[model samples]
Target: MITVTSRSELTQSDSAPDPTAEPQDGTVLFEGRHHHSGVTFFWADTPPGSGPETHWHPYTETWAVIEGDVEISADGETLQAATGDIVTVTAGTVHRFWNTGAENLRMLCIHASPELIEHEVPQD
Candidate 1:
């Protein structure tokens, strides 16, 4: 099977906020449910100082920086990823990333699930 898609052809979705971090306010490019690939892909255009909260997924997740630099916090450690850099988080690992550069940060977030399953910390 073969498929093709462009960034401009993707639909957008708003991000929800939780107690651990601010709302990402990004777009969903190719949700795993959109196809039968068993994986979800999305693009995050995070302005300076905004990103997803501390959360973990049941499946592995990866983030590839496309435009600007991003500061990723994984399991209490922080690292700066620049354009073309990719960061991976194993299943059940706590992590979050945000724009750390002056310009808007564009990154591709991929998950190993058909649907995006995000578990925010401190579940009440």
Candidate 2:
């Protein structure tokens, strides 16, 4: 089976409540479950200086930058990514992302397992 979805369709769907507001510093535009592959697509928007703290997950992830720029850090290394760039994070690797650019950063993140949801950072 094949399913097609667009940004416009997601914006208008009542079932997919706004995941954006749930995040403190940024917005999660959309997230969908893929039954066949047991994967999920999470789309989000991050304003400058907004991003999650370092954390690790059991599932692999791939993030594609759709707009603006972001600073991606993993395993003590950091790199800047612009539009059209993609970053991959293997399972169990520590990673984080920050939007340092002036405009809002848009990204599409894909996760290999639905069980890998999200893990929050602990405040020290």
Candidate 3:
């Protein structure tokens, strides 16, 4: 059978990348296990010069750029991606991204795991 999750339901029960971090302007997280799925979704309209720090996952993660541009740093290399681009980082790879465009960087972060499992690297 097919199921549907309304937009209101998503807003009512979404998670942030950092539980301790303050609410951001346009960030949303959808943990799919709550809906019987095997993946997690993290979407954001991150403004320029802003982004998450380095992080790693036990499972592969992918990012589909719906709008704007981004500079992704993965495994010691920097990759540039623009609208309509899709990038994937393998499991156990250290990666992070920043909004390099003048507008908000809109993208979908798809995690392969049923739940969100991430480890953020501490900056010096």
Q: lDDT of each prediction vs. the true structure?
A: 0.77, 0.71, 0.87
RMSD of each: 4.2, 3.9, 1.6
lDDT of 2 by residue, 47-77 (tens): 8888877777788999999998899988889
Cα misplacement distance, residue 80 of candidate 2 (Å): 0.9
Q: Rank the candidates by TM-score, best first.
A: 3, 1, 2
Candidate 2: give its CA RMSD in angstroms.
3.9
Across residues 5-124, which tens digit of lDDT does each residue of candidate 3 receive?
764466534757566666565777888888898899887779899998899999999999999999999989998999999999999999999999999999999999889888999988
Q: Candidate 1 on 4-120: residue-level lDDT in tens? A: 766666544423322344434555457757655788876777889888768999999988889998888889899889999988999999998878899888888898888778888
Better structure of 2 and 3 per TM-score? 3
TM-score of each: 0.79, 0.73, 0.91
Displacement of residue 19 (Cα, Å) in model 2 is 8.2
Candidates sorted by lDDT, best first: 3, 1, 2
Candidate 2 lDDT at 59 equals 83
